[model samples]
Every structure is written in C-alpha cells, then in structure tokens.
Target: MWKQLILLAFILANCSATEVKKCSDDKPFPLAVRVLNCEIPPCDVIKGTDMIFEIDFFVMKYVTKLTTLVRATSFGMTIPYELPEDVRDVCTNLMYHAYCPLYATEDVTYLFKFPIGNYPEVSVKVEIYLVDQDKDVATCFVCNIKVKKGPTGNTTVYEIDY
Candidate 1:
C-alpha cells in the first residue's frame, strides 16, 4: 500500500504543468505552457539539442493564419531567433487535427521544437508569441531559461510547466 501511494504521488507531481507569465499586460495568455524536461524556471537547455514546448490556447476571433516569434534577452540585449520557414508557420503544427481558419472559442494546441545552437552558457529571458493573421497576439508567454553545455545528440524528453 505504501508503495502504491508513493507511485501515485510521483505520477501526480510529474503531471503538473508549468506556470508562465504573460509577455505584456495587453497580450493574451495561453491556457497552459509545458516545456518538456523543464518543470520550473531556469529550464536547462543543453547546446545542440532540441527544446520542445507545448502551448494550449484559445482564439478570440477567426484567424486564417498564425506565425511564431521567439526572442531571447540577456545582458540587456535582445536577440531574435529566426525559426525555419517550415516551423514558422503555426497553423501546420496544431495538434489533434486542428487547422486554420481557427474560430472564436476554439481551443488549440501548438507544438514548437526549438533547436539550441552553439550559444554561450548563460541565463536568458525567452519570449514566445503567436500572432494571428491580422498581426494580433493570440498567445504570449515568457520563461527564464539557462543554457548549458552538454553532450548533445537526440532530443531529451522531460516535463516543465511555464
């Protein structure tokens, strides 16, 4: 019985999602943000690995297209990370058969795979945004992450709530 209780507790703890802050007061917040292998702030991102993020959100109006934007800030300088052309289009990455022409009150899940390159080991503030067809912010969130050097090959799967 004790073992079963401990297992249940561990499962529940692992299932908890990450808590994230909005990028701006005017920007809309996502329903939830989950970063694999990063359950808390200062998520450790190893160089030459892929960092995966899942965003759950809802649209307030019809949207024919969506784009993803990412920026990292450190030491008072902000650098925009340009996503590949294939990954920049958010509509193509929606989960569960959801597609654009997203309508009001529609729940959507977006999956983003970010490749960590050869960047200096440091802590950074990351801002992720999803913009609609009209250039309106659909979902925005900010997370603090630490980039570290490590042996990199395949993507590592972990849970992080932001």
Candidate 2:
C-alpha cells in the first residue's frame, strides 16, 4: 500500500499542469481576461468518464449574454457532439437563469462536467464568449488541448505535456 501511494504521489508531482491558451478574437474585447487555473488532463480518457471543467472569472463590466461551445476534432475535421435531451434542457434553462450576469462586481466560477466519448486524437477545444446587450463580445476565452498516449499505454510524455 505504501508503494502504491508513493507511485501515485510521484505521478501527480511529475505531470505537467494544464495550460490556459490564448483566446483569439476578430474584434477587440471590452474586458480583460485571466485564467486562474487549468488542471492537467488525462492522456487518454475512456467513454463515460466525467470530463470536468472548472473556470473562474471576474466580470469587469455588466455582462448580459453568455454562450459556450465545446467540441472535439481530429486532423482539422469537426466531430459531432450531442448532449442528452434532459441534460440539454437543464443546460438551456440553467445557463440563462443561473449564469446570466446580474452584477458587475461579482466574481463567478462556472463549472461543468462533460460525458466523454470516443474522441479522435484526443483533441478538444472549449470556447466561451460573454456578450453585452448589443451582441458585442465583452470577453472571449478559448483553450485547445491535445492528449497524447503515454508509453507503456499510460506513461507521461513530458515533451508534449500541456
């Protein structure tokens, strides 16, 4: 049991931390964006695993609209993703009611878990945009992540980490 615990500790200590990639936008965003933390992703995840996303942001202005898009792709091609109808219904209502910005001074953290599936190349991208009432972007954040299979089926590749 001690050996198992030590191994787990070593793995956790040596693995690279997840990165907060730059968000590209066509127009200037009104507010500043900062990524507090991005946890490391598993090299490969099996289907049905709960892929969690935890993000915290400070609103610099009064935000009115918010939208998020999560997708998987491989070799520059789009892969489809569909949430269950029940989940979709909750998300639709929850997004508007729970997350719709009400105060400018409030610092909010939004977290969601995605049901993982067979993703090609383990490439996933998450995009989130906060817009104002004029349909203009208040802030946009995006991250593109690619997971590489480790040696021995489950080993860390420090070269391509993050």
Candidate 2 local lDDT, residue 111 = 43
Candidate 1 per-residue C-alpha lDDT over 62-121 given as tens digits, one digit per residue, 9 for 90 to 100: 999999999999999999988897788999988889999998989999988877888899
Estimate candidate 2's RMSD in Å. Answer: 8.8
lDDT leader: 1
Supply the global lDDT for candidate 1.
0.86
Tell me, by TM-score, which candidate is best.
1
* Candidate 2 worst ten-residue window by lDDT: 28-37
TM-score of each: 0.85, 0.49
Clashes of each: 11, 0
